[model samples]
Target: MAVDAARDGVRSRAPARERLRAGGRISRAARYLFFGAVLGYFCIPMAAVLIYSFATRWTANVLPDGYTLDWWQATVSNPRIQSAFSTSMALATLTAFIDIAVVVPAAYWSRVRNARIRHVIEVAAAVPFALPYVVIAFGLMQFSGVVAPQFQGTFVLLVAGHAAIAFPFVYWAVDGAMAAAGIERLSETAEACGASPMQIVRLVVIPNISSGLVTGGLLSFAASFGEFAMAQIIGRGLDTVPLWSAEMIRSYSDTAGSYNRLAVVTLLTFAVLFVLSAVVVYWNRGQTVRLLPGAGASDEGGRR
Candidate 1:
């Protein structure tokens, strides 16, 4: 009787233990489910875009049927598409170079010569981010008439607008690089070695912060490439890639292959941006190893 009573008591306690374990497992499963749901929510759209790019038919179907490259071929063969692409590339390239030319010197000067003015300039850079594109577009339109009355509706205005909007990105990138590489201290050391200011910048500063320059350049290029509002407003007749894409999408009927061209163009842009991002990642990884001679070795030693 005593043995049976002890066995019954153990059996009674087992449910409580199992219940606690089950509750923990349920909580963990719920967490995973929630995160998975969020991931799927964001990914479905991009995946749909990718699928639609190659899809011959998608209507009334859960998945696209009959993949084809015809849309990609058509989009590429269009002369207007080519011109718009060229305009976007040219504008982006110019903006990137301009950003490097201006931000590099300006950031270095702010760090080495005057720290107080950095705040003011940084705030100025944020103007594009703080204000809406419509507001900036209106302001630019108004000022262009006063500054260069004949320059309105020109490609120069478009480039200038893109550069202005992209300034913050370039400035922030270069500034971050300067801070990370301790450029001010490096500059001082170079000065102590009898190097001129320009020499210090050209040699020590530029080499150390090359990653930042590339990042800023890529970001500027991407921003300029995709910018629509300013292009539509300031550019007027200038049909950059984004404007062209927008026009095409707007005019597209509910036909089977109409969206395919737009999707292909979008995918192309995405691929370019993705490649640039990958390059930046690769550079950053290599940079950590190359920044100082034996720097990696010393880090390993310190960790040990």
Candidate 2:
């Protein structure tokens, strides 16, 4: 009986080891291809931007006309560019701040419980994600013009518009993080240790899910920063970066220098968002490492 049992165990071990080795080999090959494609795609446009930012001329040619610092100076010295940047910074800050206040606690409440409420909130959150900006903007115009006439065509309305759109971003990202975090034990442990609900969230939960919050916040910032239609339609003279950039482009296409400067601005916008996104991805990776058994376990654990 001992011999037979030992043989059976050895047989099981052999297949398990074989499967593990095979998977590792397969993953290495797939990783190379997947990472290569991703790196290539992301780097290409930014490379073009960097090239163009320095290029005196950015046209469809075999190669760029070498490089020059004049475009750099043109972009740097423009007062309009400076104003747009300041507006973008201020607007994104307010949007992220407001969204955080609303979304984080709501996500925590919706999660850390029976999941039915979370499911409902998740569905509601999807509404903004799916709705067109045009529709949202129109709705805002309607609401602000009537019930909240004091908000119409003001910073209050603009911030509110940004916050509404940003809510779903923070809510979904943080909610997904909380779901992955093995919520019950953490909440129970915190409660047992004489922690109030608010304290449990402020210190324990938020730190653990910081990555998601940061990611969601950055994405919200980017969305608000790049918002044009809503700002243009709502904030005609208020002039956030995207709106101002659009206005500049619309008004001036005759001058090559102006276009080059605009391209530089575009590059700057893309770079900022790209860097922010990269930071979020890195942070999310860290969160995944902390929570999951291993890198591949997350996809499998969901089914479990």
Candidate 3:
């Protein structure tokens, strides 16, 4: 390997050090600009939501005329807003629990069974993802109308719909992480060493994908939280936050105060999720060893 490296080094047009030094400046600049553009695009919506939530006045101007906490106070004080927020939270928490159980085992089993089958499973997971929310919600509602009338208007219907949308996120996210990092080998090796399949999965697979899992769950939660179509179509009167906000906008244009209050609620939801996502990212980075392929795969029980 050393000799091959030396031969390859000598055959090159320029010394690697000089070539790297000469071209790195242009490459780095391109990378910076690419990332800066992406970041700016993400910041725009968030900035709008935050600024408008606090903005005391609005007009034809591009920016808010002023800012205040009246929106926050009104949002918090409104019992309707509180009810909607609570509903969203409950729905999200339920989705997270359902996702964690289903996604990991399915991903691991798909990997264990066949990679081509894995592709099929992934497609199923993502099929709903590609569809517009309203299209799927209407389909679900129509299907439910014929197949199961009992679920027409209830929290159960909302959760199932939310899970359908959120499932794609959790499945793909953790599945991608596991596939990229040889997580199956970790589990396979564990089971070979007298570890039960359940133990191997619980201790090894879960730890490695914990961050990805949580991140996926968070994405699912956020997706469910802001969901408008599912709730409108089939959630009945159990208004999730987004449905409530949309109704407020439609019903009360004369009531800008209500709009402001909805904006404040949205801002708060964003803040909480943003903080949780940051913490998950930070925690994973700090525990960096497990991220490497097979980095923490071995154990006292030999290769477990």
The lDDT of each candidate is 0.79, 0.72, 0.72
lDDT of 1: 0.79
For each candidate in turn, the TM-score is 0.82, 0.75, 0.73
**Which has the greatest TM-score?**
1
* Candidate 1 vs candidate 2, lDDT winner: 1
lDDT of 1 at 44: 89
Cα displacement (Å) at residue 50, model 3: 4.2
20-103 in candidate 1: lDDT tens per residue?
A: 223344455665676698999988888988998888888888888789888889889989888988999999999999878988
From the highest lDDT down, the ranking of the candidates is 1, 3, 2
**Which parts of model 1 are misplaced by more than 4 Å?**
1-23, 285-304
lDDT for each residue of candidate 2 in 136-218, tens digit (9 for 90 to 100): 88888987788977777777788889888777777756766776786567888999999999899888888877777887788
Could you give me the TM-score of model 1 versus the true structure?
Answer: 0.82
Q: Considering only N, C-alpha and C atoms within 3 Å, which residue pairs clash in candidate 1?
A: none
Q: What overall lDDT, based on C-alpha atoms, would model 2 receive against the true structure?
A: 0.72
Per-residue lDDT of candidate 3, residues 31-144 (tens digit): 567669899999988888788788777756888878888878777878887888888899988987787787778788888756776677656765565678888888888899
